[model samples]
Target: MKLQDILTPDCTICAVPAASKKRILEFLSSLAAEKLVNHDTFQLLESLVKRERMGSTGIGNGIAIPHGRLINATKPIAVLITTEQAINFDAIDHRPVDIFIALFVPEEECQNHLCTLQSIATIFRDKQFCKQVRQCKSNHELFQLIQQAS
Candidate 1:
């Protein structure tokens, strides 16, 4: 499925002002509530955090793909954000992460999750695209950027 299919306007966060991993994760976790992902926002946050602890998903170039699977859902939802200030995320490249795309999918549809991750990686591989994303000044701009992408 395409990302725009699930990226509602409220799910987008542009110019986020968080400065640390905990804050970033917490900020992302809170999106679950905003988007009505599930009843217990805490549970979703804990699940995502647990997955993160298994290993850092930050691959470098100021990008990170944090994702989690839930047993209560049947579809995937995504939240993309451009932080106002870069934050160290223990990325493999040891650089600060400024672009974050966190995803949530049902546990029964694991392959779709992989495809979503692949699509995000493939699109972000273009340095110019990443540059444009980092340059976005507002959520409308960020949403437009994503809409322009595959």
Candidate 2:
């Protein structure tokens, strides 16, 4: 699946003031919860947190792909965020992260999950694309940048 398939303009946030990794996850969870009917914010936070316990999703280059599986989810949902300042996320490269892309997928779709993650990673690997994402000053511009990506 493509990012546009799961991500909406409303789910993309820019210049967020979250100061810590936990707070970033909380913000993402709450944003995602707004779009997910009947989903609990606490439960969504738990899912993302549970995955982080296994390993940091912080993939370095100031980016983190925090994702989780939801048993009750019917389709994947993605939330993109750009922080006003970088925060420690336990990245492999040991650098702070400022860009976050949180994903929630149906628990049963393992293959789809992997594919989606791979797609996101591939896009993020482009330094120019990431630079543009970081340069965006508003939510609409950020969402447009992601949607217009190749």
Which residue pairs in candidate 2 have backbone atoms (N, alpha carbon, C) closer than 3 angstroms, thus clashing? none
Give the Cα-based TM-score of candidate 2 against the true structure: 0.98
Instruction: Encode model 2's per-residue lDDT on 1-150: one tens digit a residue.
Output: 877789999999999997899999999999999999868789899999999999999999999999999987988899999999999999989999999999999999999999999999999999999999999989999999998887
lDDT of 1 by residue, 1-150 (tens): 667777877888789997799888878878865665453677678767988999998989999988888887867888898898899998999999999988888888888888888888988999999999888888888898898897
lDDT of 1: 0.84
- The TM-scores, one per candidate, come to 0.94, 0.98
Error of 1 at 145 (Å): 0.9
Model 1 scores worst on lDDT over the 10 consecutive residues at: 32-41
Q: lDDT (0-100) at residue 1 of candidate 1?
A: 64
